[model samples]
Target chain A: MIEVNYKHKLNNFLLDISFTMPDKGITVLFGPSGSGKTSVLNLMSGLGNDKNKKINSRFIINDRVIDDSINRIKIQPWFRNIAYVFQDHRLFPHMTTKQNILFGYNRCNSELRPEVLIEKFKIKELLEHYPEQLSGGQKQRVSMVRALLSQPELLILDEPLASLDYTSRQELLPYIECIHKELDIPIIYVSHDIKEVLRLADYILIMDKGKIVDQGDIADLCISQPLLTQQEGASFILEARVTKIIEEDKLVQLDCGETILITAESMRLNDKIRVLIHARDVSLCLSPPQDSSILNCVPICVDEIQADENGKLRVIAKIGKQTIVSLISHRSARQLNIKKGKQMYAQFKATAMIK
Target chain B: MIELSPILVTLKLATITTLILLLIGTPLAWWLSNTSSKSKVVIESIVALPLVLPPTVLGFYLLLALSPDGFIGHFWLYISNTPLSFSFSGLVIGSVLYSMPFVVQPLQASFEMVGKPLQQAANTLGANSFDTFKNIVLPLSKRGFLVAITLGFAHTVGEFGVVLMIGGNIPEVTQVLSIIIYDHVEVLEYTQAHYYSIGLLVFSFIVLFVTYSFNRKLMVRL
Candidate 1:
């Protein structure tokens, strides 16, 4: 685990935070712009600390005390073993792809083989080309290899995909996924994009105005985070495993406590995935609705009923142990007489999948 | 027939001056580019003084400083038992001072262009300051070095007023290309003057032309 306690004065606010993040999987720093997210990263990585002084901080990564004001121990950035991949892809313009990737490897004398990384990142053909010669996605992939070759104790990705177009970003997601799956290095990824957070984040830290207001596992916290995006309604993530594939309908059957079949033909059997279901899209019925257009209808026990600001009723229910919320009207609630512990069927169609 | 000694002396002086300026200017320009100190502006203005001040004006003060009784000359005399005024060494010191901005400004601008992002990137990649400078910065700033060397060498080669004040017109010791051309003109040797003058012009044009062409190609490659 990485333990961080930092107190620094910013332009408009005093940033005081102390938190611990899991040492494995992708822990995302999610926040709006100007929320001191990058500042937190800079403090952890010891970047821009020469100018950003008067910082009272303590950081211990996996029991290694990287910095401590009380003990007066501070490691310089080079020796800190914390590598960073920037948003702009800070590749050396004078060097070719091979030279850029080997720059850190040669200095650190890392045991990680360079050829394996070159093959894994799929840049063997472009190894001789300069950074300017590569496209945006290719450049980011090369930079990722460059950082990983350093064999850092921790890796900080400050919105690496923020600069790419939709297509390029889509292309680069798998490479990032490969890093966490294939390597043991803990990553601290900073981003404000909800799609990426939903897709990649195993743990989430929500920030606002220089404070970590909330944090938890993405699946557990995904339901309560109405702040994910203002444009989209509330959504929840369900952890499921694909059980079967129905190619005739281009669907994959999932086991998320109950059976769910989503229209994702690419998913293979036994593949674990997260199904994003918006609360508004979900509707509750007194009994399991038959002969309906909705593909999903699951029996859930009503756990609670609460009135929302929009004069609508938010019906909370559970399918086995997993929770799912449905936004229903007060009239529908009065008609169905839904209440706590009442059994009902929840229906949602066309759910998004993160595989 | 043209004498070879003057050409040889000029070449030596320009070559030596360019080397010294680079050694001194690289760090100074780097410091200038990266520092936010209050003295940065003061040092910048001092370096740029040669660009605005009359060469004769600077040379008059330099001549005093290089004299045996003056500050630098007294120290040199005490240390080496040789006078600096009207000597080859004095010419170099004067040329370095006169060509300060020509070398420093380009180096400074290019170093600034390389910027802090790459340096920070290098630091995180396990390279210390010197390693980052040698491996990451120096190679990236090659164009700046080229511009700096070209301007420094060409400016020192073409120096006349400061060379006149501090170096005088001693044959084989202190006489450079510009001073020899002036000497030929002074004696009303119009033929010799044209030969040397045209030589200096063509030499300068060719040097600048070759450098700019090379610079353009580098730009395209990048």
Candidate 2:
């Protein structure tokens, strides 16, 4: 676990935040601007050194005390074994891409092979070129390779995609996924984009006005704080395993609570996936609808019903042991008499967000 | 006939002064660019004093300091047992002080332009401050070094009042191009003065032209 508690006085606000992150997954720091997200990363990486700013903090990573105000033990950033990929991709302008990637590798005497990262990031052809010659997506890819070649215990990415256009961002997302899937190093990714957060985060820390408002596993946080996701629709994720594939119809069978059909492509049987079901896409019925053309209509028990600010009722129900939410109109809830402990059938079509 | 000794002496003095300024000015400029202490302003003003103050006024104080009984002269005499007044060594000391700002300002501006982002990036990438400065900051400041060297050399070559007040026009030792030109005009030998004046003019123009052209090429790659 990586634990941190930090307090700093900014010009307009005081930033006081504390949290512990899992050791080996992407824990995203999500917030709007001026939320002190970058400051947290700086403090952990030991780059928050300014003469006027007095930061009182304690940061420990896996039993190693990186910073402790009480003990007066603050390691320099170079010695902290942390790699940071900044928003601007601050590549050395004087060095070619090859030398830039090898900078940290040569400095730390790292045992990781540079060629492995070079090939993984697909920067072989761009090695001889300088940073100015590469495109934005290509530069970010090189920056990631540069960070990974150091073999850091933790990696920090500060909105590495914020500067890129839509096409570049789409191109770079899979490379970021590879960082977590192919490599075991823990990563602290900072982003305000909801789509990036939902796709990349295994855990989430929500910040507002320099404070951590809430944090938990991504699935729980999405339901608990819908506003934090900032996505247009309320969505909940379901962890399921693919049981079969009907190739003729381009549909995959997932076993979440029961056999469910989702429109997905290139999915193999036995592959685990997370299906994002938007609350608006689901509807309720007193009995299973026959010949309705809805692919999924699973029996569920209403656990609770809560009124939302939009004059709609968010019906929380259990399909077997798994939780699903449906946002339905209040008039419909009154007409159907949906209440706590009510038994009904929830129907929806699953959209595969990630395979 | 034109004596070549003054030209040679002037070249030698300018060469040595430029070399020494680079060695000392680089670190001083680096510190000035990066430091936030209040004392930085005081040091910066002192380095810049030569830019505004008349050269004769600066030469007069340097003349006092280089005399046998003056503080710096006494220290120098203690080490080498030679009075610094009117010596080639004294002229060198005078020229260094006169040309300090020219060398340091360009370097400081260059260092500032490189900024803190790249250096922080280097630190996080496991490079210490010294390594980052050497590998990153130094190479990126190539244009600054070029400007500093060119301006420092040219300013030292054109120095007249400081060299005259300190070196006293001694032949083959302290005489320089500017002093020789002054002596020829004092004697109403306008033809002799023209030879040196036009040569200095062409040299200065050529140096500036080459530096700016070369800098433009370097900028494209950067």
Candidate 3:
């Protein structure tokens, strides 16, 4: 686990953050712009000055103190066994792709070579080219490979994908996901985008101003608090394993641990997919409707109903063990007698399951 | 046709002055680029004194300091049993001092432009300070070093008043190209002076052209 507790002031922003991340999963530092996410990464990498009384920070890998300010022991950035992929890529402009990759591997104390990593990232075709010749996605991939080749115990990605377009983000997401799954090394990802955090993070740390206001498993924290709920739309993440493909109807059945339903697409059987169900796409019914055009209908138990500023009620419901959120009028909810433990059917269009 | 002896003397003086300036001015420029001390401004002004000071005034000071009875003169005389004034080595010292700013300023600017990032990157790559400078900083500032060398050589070649004060117009030894041209002008030998002056002008122009062209190329590359 990586434990951090430190404080520093930059201009008008005061950073007083403390958190511990599991050593084997993607821990995302999520926040809005101008928050202290980037500063936290910088402090971990020794790129910023340390302040406060004996700033007690430690990157404990298997119980070893890599950095402990109270003990007056701080390992240098080079020796910290951590690799950082900056937002801008930070590729050496003067070096070719091969040379840039070799730059990290050459300095690494480990015996692992860079050729395997170069091939794994699929950058071999562009090895002779300079950074200027590569696209944004390609540059990020090369940077990731470079950091990985350094054999770091922990890889810190500071918004590495923030500079890419939607198309490029799609292209790069699978590669990052592959790295997260294949490599045993832990990754600390910092981002302000909730969509990305939902997609990649197993653990999440939510920051406001400079403090970590909330943090927990991505599924729990995203559903339980008003933090992720403030995005105007109802945000819910559904983790399901594809059970079967009904290609005749152009639909795929997903078994989300409790309910199995046909989605709009024919995804490969047994492949796990995380689908985002926006609250605007869901409608409520007192019972199963006999003849509805909507393809997705599941029995749900009302967990809570809370009123918004517009006198609208946000209904949080539990479908088996999974929680799904929906927005409804307060008057309608009161008339329908919707309250805790009420059994109802939540209907959504199959297309609402974002791939 | 001009004699080969004066050309050889000019070449020797340029070579010697360039070498000495490179040795002394490089470290000075590096220090100036990195130092945050308050005395840096005062030291910078002192280094640039030769740029505005009349060459004759600087030359007069050198003459006094190198004369037998003067402070440095007495010390050198006590060691070598002869004054440094009117000697070949004394002219080299004068040229180095007069051309100090030309060699140091470009180097200082280049060092500043190299900035802190590259060095820090190298340090994190397991290179110590000196190794970082050798592997990273020096290669990155090659253009600036070239500019320094060219300006130092050209400036030393064109020095006159300081050389005149200290070297006393001696031929085949202390007589450099500028001094030879001065001698030609003093005797109303316009043709000889024209030949040497044109040569010096052409050489200086070539040096400046090369420096500017390389600088432009670097900008494009960057």
Candidate 4:
């Protein structure tokens, strides 16, 4: 596990944040820009100083004190056994891909070699080339592979995909997911993109203005306080295991305790999928209408209703204990007398379910 | 038809001077580029002092400093029993001082352009200070180093007043191309003077041309 509780004051910004991340899977630090996401990473890597008196932190790899500020102990970045991949791929221009990958491996006390990592990252063909010869996505991939070659205990990535184009980001997303799944090492990824947080994060830490507002498992935290109500585009994260594939209809059946039919393309059987249903995309109805073109109409009981910024009412419906948000017009809500304990059907088009 | 011995001597002196300037100027320029210290102004003024001072004045000071009774001269005499005045090494030292600005200014500009991100990246990548300097700073500033070397060589070769004051025109020892041309001119030997001056001018032009072409290639690649 990685624990951090520190505070520092910059010229005009005050950064006081405390959070802990589990030792396995991807922990995403999600926030808007200028929310001290980068500063948190820098503090962990020893690039910035923490000036708090009670700053107790540790990255315990089997009970090792990698960082213990309370005891006045800290490990240098190089010896901390953590790899950081910055937003921009900081590839050394003087070195070839092979040399860049071998740089950390050369310093590591372990016996892992660069050739194995090169072949694993599929960069064997580009090993002799320089960073300038590759594209942005290729550079990021090489940097990731270079970071992993050291066999670090933890990996920190600060918006690694922000600089790439949309297509490049799409191309690299699966590779990041693969890294999280293939390696047993925990990862702390910082990003502003909610879709990436939903896709890759096992645990989410929501930060704003240098403070961690909330943090928990990705599924539970997505629908809770401050994350769902305060965030503009916040939605629910449903972890569904694929039960069957409806290949003829171009749909897949997912079971999150309730069978959900998603119009997802190119999915294999029994593959775990994460689906995000934005609050704005869902509507509530008193009864299931048969003449509707919507493919998803899950029976739910209205749990609560709250007014949004524009006075539009958002009704939280609980379908078998899974809370889903549905935005309804105030006039319709009033006419339908939608209130707490009202039975309703949460209706949404199958295409609105994004993975 | 012309004696090429002095031409060879000039080339040798300029080559050695340029080498020393590069070896010493790179770190100086890097420091100047990154340091926020108030002493930067003083150091810059000191480095640039040779540019504005008359060549004869600089040569006289150097001669005095390297004289048998002078401070550096007495120290050298005590250590090696030999003064540094009126020798090839003395000429090299004088040339480096005279052409110091040429070598340091380009390097400073290049170092400034290579911003902090590259260095910080190297620092976080398990590279120490010296390794970062060798790997990131040197390679990124290759064009500037080339420019400094070429300009320093050209500037040193064209030096006349300093060599005249200090070198004493010892043929095949300290007699460089510029001094050879000056000697011919003083004797009203216009043809020899013209030949030597033209050769020096052509050499400088070639160096500058190569510098510009290499810079162009760098721009294209970047």
Per-residue CA lDDT of candidate 4, range A43-94, in tens? 7777654444245455455576767766867776666777889899988877
Fraction of real interface contacts that model 1 preserves = 0.95
Cα lDDT computed for each candidate against the true fold:
0.87, 0.89, 0.79, 0.80
Worst lDDT 10-window in candidate 4 chain B: B213-222
Candidate 2 chain A lDDT trough over 10 residues, lowest sum = A226-235
Candidate 1 backbone overlaps, count: 0
- Candidate 2 residue-wise lDDT, B1-222, digit = tens: 899999999999999999999999999999999998899989999998888889999999989999998988999999999989999999999999999998898888889889899999899999999999999999999898998898889989999999989998999999999999999999999999999999999999987786777564322110
Off by over 4 Å in 1: A229-233, A304-314, A328-340, A350-355, B214-222
Per-residue C-alpha lDDT of model 2 across residues A24-89, encoded as one tens digit per residue: 999999988888998888888887754577878899999999989889888999999999999999
A229-310: candidate 3 lDDT, tens digit per residue? 7665547777887877888877778877555565556467777777677776778999878898877888889998877655
Chain B structural similarity (TM-score) per candidate: 0.94, 0.95, 0.93, 0.92
lDDT of 3 by residue, B168-209 (tens): 877788888888887888999999999988988899899889
Ranking by lDDT: 2, 1, 4, 3
Clash pairs (backbone) in predicted model 4: none
Give the distance in Å from residue A351's predicted Cα in candidate 3 to where it truly belongs: 8.5
Q: Which is superior by TM-score, 2 or 4?
A: 2
Compare the candidates by DockQ and give the number of the best one. Answer: 1
lDDT of 4 by residue, B38-127 (tens): 899899888888778899999999889877787777787789876778877778878989999888888887887776767766656666
